[model samples]
Target: MVWLFAIATGLIVANLYYAQTLIGPISRATGLDPGAAGLIVTLTQIGYCLGLLFIVPLGDLLENRRLIVTALLTTAVALLAASMTSSAHLFLFAALCIGLGSVAAQIVVPFAAHLSRPETRGKTVGKVMSGLLMGIMLARPVASLVADAFSWHAIFVLSAATTAALALLLRARLPQRQPAGGMHYFELLGSMWQLLKTTPVLRRRAAYQACMFGAFSLFWTCVSLELTGPYFHISQTGVAIFALVGVAGAIASPIAGHRADQGKSRSTTAIALTLGAAAFAMPLLIHSSRLVDLGVLVLTSVVLDMGVSANLVTGQRAIFALPAEIRSRLNGLYMALFFMGGALGSSLGGWMFAAHGWTGVLWTGLCFPLIALCVFATE
Candidate 1:
């Protein structure tokens, strides 16, 4: 069941990112203005945030298996629509729906938490999150490779088929979970604000992850531009290979989860934040050789990914420890908050790289974790 949940979450979440690295090709194919090309990814994220706030909370008010299956089907349809559309407007709308439906991955997460025993919940959530993180890290390279072999449209077509099949398999295999909550839909939504106000643990964990994820986003967003520029002149295939290297960082997820289970969350968080800060610092040191400098950036990717993965699992473990009835709402709020930070970080990273180059991006990314570390101290 753990493996199934992990695979399912990974596949579903990958839908949200298939467009990120394909933004140029997608925009060109769809006749979208290059100036507005960022919307290919931005609208999807906006839809995801909306769904995290509006749809994921329904996990506490609806039958869990049904909700997951329905969401997956929606994503499948959206992917199919995206594949067939040549109109930028239509494709953009499909991108939004893809993000909205991909929140099924989040629903699967809390469901995994609920099924696990209290003593092992952290480990369970950690394992599942490792898959989610892998999907995020792998989606870009997979998209690039697919587009290289085929057209960009083929990527969406293949994903649509896979998502539909996944939905069917999950529907057949997943156990039914009818949430015990009696709150109406609107009431369930309203209570998230209350949870935010009253739950200090949620607030702190969300804030910490927001910063960590912000740093993660900053580095990743700018790194591609840096590699493709005059410094490295790395081809798309080379960039894809660099992305694959970062998957090693997902190993930290289960380790951090096991530590959190041992009641070491505080220390684990501190270590994670420090590692995030150090990732940026490593790239700041000047190296004369281009090869040596590229090697340093590769190391930075691994270290930064490890820090983000560890902190994410730690935060999820902390929040999932809350009451069962409120776990879904808490998860939704937690993800929504941190996702906003990611949005800001990516936006900031692009501007920084353009305005002040890699040095500026590194310094800005460094501040994200340093800020998180400061907040960790207060806890």
Candidate 2:
């Protein structure tokens, strides 16, 4: 069941990121202006934030299996729309819907938490999140490879088919979890604000992740542009291989979860934040050769991803330890906040790369984790 949830979450969330590496090809195909191309990633995240706010709370009021299946189907339709569209406007709208529907992955996550015993809940969430992180890490490379071999449109067509199939599989396999809360939709929505205001852990953890994720988003959004530019002139296939380096970071998810289970969340968080900041500094250290420079970037990807993955698991573990009935709401609020940060990061990253180049992007990305570390100090 844990593995099922992990795989489902991974497949579903991959929809949100298929365009990150294909920004160049997608922009050219859709006739989108280079300056505004960040919208491809940013609008999706904004749509995701809106869904996290409006849709995911339903997990606390509705049947989990039904909600997950419905959302996945909706995402399938959006993916198909994306594949078929030529107008930038239509494709961008489809991208937004893709983010909106991908919240199904968030629903599966809390359901996994709800099903686990209290003693092992952190470990369970960690294991499931490993799949989610892998989806995030792999989406770029997979998209790159597919685009290199076929057209970029083929990737979306493939994802749509897989998502629809996964929806059917989850509906058949997942246990029905009808939340006990009797609040109306509006009332349930209202309570999320109170949760944000009242829960100090939720706020602090959310803020920490917001900054970490901002840095993560910024680095990834610009890194492709950097690699494909004159400095590296990497082909799509090479970019795909470069993306595979981050998969090593997924190892940190379960380790962080185990430490959280051992009552070491604070120290784990500190390490994670430190790692996030250190990753940006690495690229600056080595300027000797193009080969060495690429190696440093590879190391940076692993370290940065490890920090984001570890911090995310620890934060979720902390929030899930709160009242059971509010688990979905807490998760919703948590994700919405950080993903808003992600949106901001990606948007800024694109503009920074265009106006000031990779050096500018790196310096700007560095600020995100530095801010996070400062916030962590207050805790």
Candidate 3:
């Protein structure tokens, strides 16, 4: 049943990544400026951030299944609209809706927490995140291939169709649980500040995730720049191809979770994070080798995903152990910071790349995990 939640997360979250590869083709197809292409992703992130902040708290008050289903329906419609759009503004709007609706994954994750016993919570979260990593890892190269073989619009159209099918499957399989009494919007918003200042665990873990995700974003953002430059002279397609190396990391996510189940979640998290930090050294050590690039990309993907998934599992395990009424609020607070960190990371990575090349970006990225390590050690 929890694995059912995993499938649900994977399919729905894939919608968010659909644009990763299709962004270029979509821009070319619509004759939009390359600079505006970032809007596609930015709008999506904004919408997801909005949903995490505003809509997700409803999971604590509303029926989780109903919220999940309704959100999925909205997501499908948004994707359909994206497929039909030739106008840039319309596409941007559609992305916002798509992003807002995609927070169904938030509902699904906490719902997994609701389903599991305390002892197994880390492992359960790990299982669910494994699915997320798989969706994210495959979404890049796969979406590119789909857009290349077909048309860019085909990406959104197929997403809508697949989403509709998934919605149907979920209707029967997903359990709708009515949580305790409702939380008002103001209270939900208010609690975020309170959680940050008051809950030591929440504060510490959220900070850790923020920094780590910053580094994660840094890795992905600049890897393409490095690959597509003179040393590799690789095409954008080859950059996408290199992302496939991350599939190994996706495969290793469950191991992180399994270890978490044995009461080793924190230790597992630290080790994974340390390995993730080392992955940043790959390019610094070996300046110009395709084999090194591929090897390091795969290894880095493994450690980074493993670290992130583990930390998230650990965090969820701890949070879910709290009173059930506050779980949604907890998630909303944590994810807001997480997403905001990703936004900061991407922006900073762009700056570093522009000013100092891929190596500069790498240097900037290496700082995040080291900072995270220190934070973890002290906390």
Candidate 4:
């Protein structure tokens, strides 16, 4: 059952990343400028934040299986719509739908947290999160490969099919869980605010994830430019290779979870943030060497991914332990802030790349880790 949940969660979650590796092709095929290609990512992120805020809290008020399957269907249909579109306006509309459906992964994570025992909740959530993390990491390489072999639209066609399959699997195999009604819909949002305003730890951790993710977005958003330009001059195939380096950390996540289970999250989080800060320094140092860039990229991905996943689970575990009645609302609040940070990062990365090039983007990258450090230091 747990493994079933993980696979379903991973597959559904991967939709969030289809645009990550496909940005270049989407730009070329759509004839949109760099900043415009960036909007494809930015709009989806904004949509995701909306879902997290408005839809996710319904997890507390609705039926779990219905919500999951309904969102899955919406995602599948949205992918189909995305594939059929050539007009930029229509494509952006599809991206919004994709974002709404993609955040179902967020709902699934918190659901898994609720299903597990307190002693094992961290491990369970971490395991499911590893799938989510892998989905995020692999989207780059996988999308690159698919885009190279076929048209950019083909990526959405495949995703649509995958979403359909996962929906079937989830319906056939996963047990049903119902949502608990602790507060009304408006009350839920109100409670989230009340919690955020009142809980110092949740605010601190959410803020940490937010800031670091912004920096993370800044680096990835402009990396395509770096790869396409003089130094590497790589095609889509070449850029995807960079994403494969991230799998190392995805592989390391289970161990990080084990350590979290041992009550070592606070220290682990600090160390991870410190490593992430150092990792951002890579582009500054290995500005032109392919081999050196590859090495740094892989190592930094390992550290940064581990840190993000660990801190995320730690924050959730802490929140979940507080009170059972408000778990869904808490999850929604945390993730809404988290993905909003990602949008800011992606947008800022695009602007920085335009204004200052890689050097400027690196300066943007520096902000995420520094803020992460402050989060750890103060907390």
CA shift of 313, model 3, Å? 1.9
Tens digits of lDDT, candidate 4, 1-379: 5676677777877787778767777767666787666788888888888888888888888877778888899999999998887778888888888889877787787778777898888788778878877887788778888988997888899999999888777777656777668567898777778888988877877888887677666666777677777876778887788777766666545666667778887887777677667767866776546777756666666666666666666666677676766677788888889889999988888878777887888777877878878767876
* Number of the top lDDT candidate: 2
How should the candidates be ordered by lDDT, best one leading? 2, 1, 4, 3
Best candidate according to TM-score: 2
lDDT of each: 0.90, 0.95, 0.76, 0.77
RMSD, every candidate, angstroms: 1.6, 0.6, 2.3, 1.7
> Per-residue lDDT for 1-379 in model 2, tens only?
9999999988989898999999999999999999998999999999999999999999999998999999999999999999999999999999999999999999999999999999999999999999999999999999999999998999999999999999999989998898997899999999999899999999999999999999998888889989999989999999999999888999999999999999999999999999998999889666878999999999999999999999999999999999889999999999999999999999999999899998898889889999999998998
- Candidates in descending TM-score order: 2, 1, 4, 3
lDDT by residue for model 3 (262-325), tens: 7776787687668668878765676456777666666666667666666666666666667788
Count of residue pairs whose backbone atoms collide, per candidate: 0, 0, 0, 0
Q: Give the TM-score (vs. native) of candidate 4.
A: 0.95
- TM-score of predicted model 1? 0.96
